[model samples]
Target: MFRDTQSSWMSTLRHDVPASLVVFLIAVPLSLGIAMASGAPLAAGLIAAVVGGVVAGALGGSAVQVSGPAAGLSLVVVDLVHTYGWRATCMITLLAGAVQLLLGVFKAARAALAVSPAVIHGMLAAVGVIIALAQLHVVLGGSPQKSAVANVLELPGQIADLHGPKVAIGILTITVLAVWTRLPRVFRAVPAPLAALAAAAGTAWAFGWDVTRVDLSGSFTEWGFPVLPQGDWHLIVASVLLVALLAGCESLLCSVAVDGMHGGRRVDLDQELTGQGVANMVAGALGGLPVAGVIVRSTANVQAGARTRWAAILHGVWVLVFAVGFGWSITLIPLEALAALLVFIGVQMVNLGHIRKVHGHGEVPVYVVTMAAVILLGLAEGVLAGLALAVLLALRRLTWVTVRKRDDRDGRTRVTISGSLTFLGVPRLTHELRTIPYGAAVDLDLNIDFMDNGAFEAIHSWRLDHERMGGTVVIDELHDEWYALAASGARTLPAKSPLKAPDRWWLPWAQRRRGAEPVTVPPDGVSECLVTAGTREYHRSTAPLVKPIFTELARKQQPSHLFITCADSRIMPSLITASGPGDLFTVRNIGNLVPRRGSEPHDDSVVAAIEYATQVLGVRTITVCGHSGCGAMAGVLSGGVRAGSLPGLRRWLRHGNHSLATFIETEGDRLHAGALDVLCRVNVQQQLENLRTYRKVDEQVREGKLELVGLFFDIGSARVHLVPPLRPTLCVKPFDRPVVAGEE
Candidate 1:
């Protein structure tokens, strides 16, 4: 009895029409500019845009992503055209489309992400530099050289002999684009590219300047079919593959990025690849340039409220209608204006923000080297060089290890080795063990992941030599039992290693058996896992360092604030408050909740704790803190645990009923925005109000003898936000207190 439901047709038309118009307007100038930059006919750019929008939009996985000729692939197109001629380049594009289609059919689209981002961005940046260099000659009304170095060498001559009218138009276009973004919002509704084109074209006409313009007299009527490339068979195949992989990577990455913009549906990368391949094939057959997902139009589509693929298809229709009916107007746009647009775009591709972001991750060397190689050598060479460097960096990080040696309290030496253990670490292991006294007892802690036979034998031989001189050598494996397995004559271990948790505590509370012996730090040297490492650390360092602070705290604890919070291990009151020892008397429970007076069973524990904290401890302030992503708030919101499953726990959650009710009454309609986060804040405020139901707390508050506050801690951000209560608002607000020092 499954029935299909669909949204109203009116709703579809309402959203898609306006979004289509906006994307269409933005695509017109960019398509032409990219085409001009790639040395393809102006009609080829329009053809690609139309095919990308209609074909890809209808068949692609991403709903809002728009496709067109991309500036990122301009250099690739230019190189192919120069080597194979325009018609043969179209055949290469066709072959690339076939390759992409095969790749999509095989479901290998997601593998495209295996390439390093440093290499990708570097490749793009190099293309940017190349485009800017070549387009600079075009802007100056001079023919561009084959390579970037030649362009650089002849750039001074072009500048010296710059055509006055063309140079004026180019400068005016660049100037308009640079300043257009800073104009008033009302004046900027037109896309910057269109505005720059209009300004340059208008100036050329008004001043009677002789500037080159786009000529598309018989483009559609005289378009011819593509011919096969006459180059070496292997080179032709390689050229096809280069186009396919580059276009595929660009389109896939753009789709993934666009997916983050909406919550409607995730991009199906394989389907998107198939759609792009199909679009490229169609465009190639029509003598158009290679098509890919262009971020400019895609972003515009999303921002303009596109709800479905209809907007993308409609955009293509609009472009087709305009090109067929009003194609004459396009010829009026000055060539220098288009060159200036490409130059601006090319400069922007070498993004300072992107460079800074990758620089922080220590990938600047790869990015810089790739960019240099691309400008000096070529696109494929630069990417391969960057990928090689990135691989080396990854391998170095994976194989890194650290070894620490310290003398124990009882005249024995302890060695802690961590990370992967292989033959590479054998020399360091041998040198360190030999430094220990010949007759001294030794404690070896192997906190390693994997161990090769060479590392095992080095340690085994060292232990034997020490024991021959009457020295006791004890070895403990903190993680995997590498030594034990080796001793049992197993040369190779299982590929899947054991799960190792932090040894903050030796054993779980529920797992401890009766009569289990207490784990102690060895008198001679401590060599154990993380569970006992804290106790050992305390014995070795912390206890002595904090002796004075603890000695004073032991005498008296007169805390200024009585902090009540959830039992979540991450919510540490002292850590947040920057308190050393006993600055706050604390109470931890499931939800940081306070029940109404005489309302619930099993509420005595919380009531008594508050009573003792207030009446006995006489603390000045009482703070109830809640946190984001709280299990208790989420449980109450979602009913995650059944009352039958944990009756006792369910009874305790009844205290949160008022908080839930308050949230529904105040902000229920906006729950989809952030339900758990809003509930966490509301619960903190509700508990503060509940504290007033207690006569003692109310009396103290009224008499100016106490303060009540609510706090919210965001786990991911590590920020504490003050919650404003609605009822019986406190005289002293949470923000009234100065922020904790050094938190951020």
Candidate 2:
């Protein structure tokens, strides 16, 4: 495995050279035009190409992908040059490079997620618009212009500077080139640029016509020394930012594309960004334009059967040789053809259909992003806005406040919350506080077992907001300790549940598009097994978790807690509880069974776990948890799963559950299905003492570190709950409240 990883990197060089040569054929003319457009030395573009291809190739995370003075950054470079002084711009570029390197070192790839999708679209659109306009001049046999307006205004410029001979030559070359590109298999093997350049130059020489050509005098000196342009630090700084964005976006995108095509591991986004930044900085210092990954050439390389870095290196060598040796041949070709190709690329960038789809969901927000992308030409801005919209949605979901308002005995209002708090729930919490009845003693009874930092911080913020009004937020059983433990705290955030959210967009779409039926796996142990509770059921299937518990129980090592769960028929007690036959000494219940001290119990299961753990097994850590959306919970809440349907259930659930009624009695109006997660948790806490009545647990807990844990399991959600110590009070989903921002 280690050698395979090492060898994969080694092959990057062997495959890159030939591919680079093909890309070089495509890059030379583009480099000069883009540099000319940016008002930089023509040679600077070639320098950037070398750095992006050779240097970036050497340092980048991926093995293949072409890079060079990109057209995308030309406008930004020009503007920065006009504003910051090229020297200061260069300094900024250097700074940007340093920042990228630092980011990579710190593993800040996640930072890319912070950039709004809107800004990215806007940036691309701006680049596309610029390309379309600038290319029009080349298509019309004239120098490129700045904008759509300028391209139109300069109609006379092409007429006045009309080089008829170059125009005729360029047109003929383009025609032949197009033919050669579209030819059948045999002729297609010939490089289009080779045929186009040879024919165009040969035709120009035969006619002996005056035409524009590349100026290579400044690019070389005695014995072909590298001729560099003089620029101060400011220009470098301005250059780097444009280069950084271009390089970062392009390289990462290339990585994504290649990963898909090659069935390889993902590209290291952070590493690639840093490599790009460094490559741009090196190119700039060497008097080159900025560089970024180009998909067209990368595709070409891949299609050409490139297998190693040699292809890329050879391509760079070809670029250098093409420009330096037959440097004068390029002057014979006209500019119109290049512009047409760029225009085609620009058109591809605008996805109007995508825009319409986006607008359907949120028009205002999508419009703002589009405007930022098209009008301001700010890629980062639009992207940032899009990201902010997503964050707002997430925060609204996390910081939800469920206010269960029930009528009081004296006709007053009673409120209780039996759910989690998270950043997503923030908006609901705020909304609930605003809807409170005026002049009522808001009995804010909270029982949250699953909370996170964002939710915790939001709770703190809400407290200030809620207290500002006349309402009292009495937090009962608030598990702040779990929420306070910075990273990877006791309970993690819950994923969108199929049972709760039902928003798996891709799943159904994939099935429909593929026109395939779903596969069915044997449900040996699932949700049904999670809720089924009884000692006899434990011995039936000989499930892995039940066997050890049974053995230990048979051996007189009684378990301390009665575990009630869903009867999905998939959950094996031994597997979930991680016990062998004689270990757990357990009792099974549909919902995890914890009998309240005063609650009645028809079965001895609840008492069994306590007796086993305390008296026989002498174990600690008695935990009772309800798996997510226990059919029993749904039944009791919906009045469907009561013991009447399953006689034993109606009888057994009496002692093991009470949180639903407790919430309805205190606060029902503000309560919603979101708390289904919490209700399961609260039931576990209520049952902890059902063990104590077994008589052994009460004495053992006082003597040892015997801990009591309450949990809720969801059938579909990937999150697990850990109710922290909120003694003298019981809280469910407490981790949802926010006391500090990223404090853990």
Candidate 3:
């Protein structure tokens, strides 16, 4: 525990210190500016920023998110302050914090995610417009009007009679903030807002401009408590709820956005809400504005390499220290410069990137309506309008249907209906059904569910009318039997298993499509399985790809090599070698063992295949492939095949007696693990020697007419290992070969 603590502290010192400094620089200007725009004391913004960092950071769910005053809530705060005064507005903020705490306690924060993204973006855009309009007045050396409309109408006059020095300072601040990003790399480490404010301060001092500056009064010596409102109780309560919901929604949304920007830990929405609520309560009780998760500071913290929440907490400590010790330095910043900063931030809140994204999802109408209504009417009115449109669009998708009509080759009209069949889809279904010819045979397929009475009656009556005109109507259901159940007057039916597709293992790669219909399998009989495999491969998957290869193989076949292997069903010579038609002539037998040329018990099948491949086809190579887990080898080791159940069968296995003798001579009486596997490999070498008993095979090996190869396949590891020859006289590759089976 002690070691872990020391490591954590060292990590924080390395990463969090620099990030905290960057966030502190960003938070100072934004905190003061948002408070000024909201018609509150400048100190309130700083107080909220401090409380948000220290209190929320210590208990928040996100590891690196920085919390502070946000510009998106400026419109609401301004209206509340104007109606109830700053003291009463602080009381409303406190009440809202209580409500948020209750919501977090009940774990209701996840419900806020269901709100439409279009509506959320529209709300932020509306707030941005309001902030921009109001701060523009302040930048022009005039106070804002009562509402957004009043401020807009009076903006023309304020611009025409703009005060000279303050307007110049505001423009200088906006210019510096805009161009800071395009500056050289060295200048980027310093926060752009701090750089802009410093330039504004320097310019004002040099020119002796009489611009308004920040007023903190006595700082920490004069802290004020919140006062209760005297308005109607219900109205006050509703206002509190709105404030809490908006603040909670904005904070949770910022956390979600920040979660995507990092690869580390993810944020917990419930715990983050509780932290914001607790921070708001502390800030409001001390005469501060409402607090939220601010994206600007959070993004800056992430970019600056913060690894923990200690950065956010330390940033708050720095702000509080700066406010108490160096209060005079903050007072030197001109209010017009701060307002210019707010105007820039407000403009950015209406993001064009987000607008393009929502437009792609066909939610642009909801975004546009909400934004316009908020700007022209009010925030609540705009949000409600957007929400209503989102609900209507969702309902339209739930009952959507598609009806497709086609003419079949068998003199029938086919109609396929998909998606939910409800009352809303009846009109479209009826119109499509009437378009079919009256006396034509109909095959209707329903790949749908949820059939209502209105749709059922329309389809049933159409089918009956067509049948009465000397036409046959055949109905086939794919997904559900809704139409049949309703026609038979049965509300319920027994559940049946879904139909399984017939095996299509013979299809080649190019001939198969995913999810195709299965061909029917015939009953088991002598030639039934052969007919099924042959027909399915030719008609379904084979003929289209390589018909010429099969056509040429039909007349005369010439193969390069003869492959001899065990009769294990898992082994496929063509699949392993990647060889197509007329590549390898194959001979499969139990254990892949070869009998001597003049042995007492001779196998005519093996001798004849070797003669046909080598002498007739002029094959150059003969490969003997043995596999692990050979039942023949296991039976030889266990003496299971030596029983006298059948004399003919026992005589046939005499060729494998040499392999059993090798296993007993090399290995002792104790059979360890993998003893049978070791014997299976030695059996391949024994069989290769036995193949030379034929005078033709021995002469070909010396005359170079054929190359003899021995292969051992390990089924468990899916690898093929070459068996070394007992003597150096064999003509083959000198190196041991190990190949990953099935790999080309």
Poorly placed runs, candidate 1 (over 4 Å): 1-11, 405-414, 425-443, 462-474, 494-499, 502-744
Report the lDDT tens digits of candidate 1 across residue range 327-358: 99998999989999888988988989879988
Could you say which candidate leads in lDDT?
1
Compare candidates 2 and 3 on TM-score and give the better one. 3
lDDT of 2 by residue, 312-397 (tens): 55666677776677767665554444444455445555658546755665544644554455445444454455556666754654
- Which pairs, if any, clash in model 3? none
lDDT per residue (tens digit) for residues 228-313 in model 3? 98889988998898888888888888888888777678898999989988988988899888988988899999999999999999
Cand. 2 TM to true fold:
0.49
TM-score attained by model 1: 0.70
Q: What is the TM-score of each candidate against the true structure?
A: 0.70, 0.49, 0.68
Residue-pair clash count for candidate 2: 160
Better of 2 and 3 by lDDT: 3
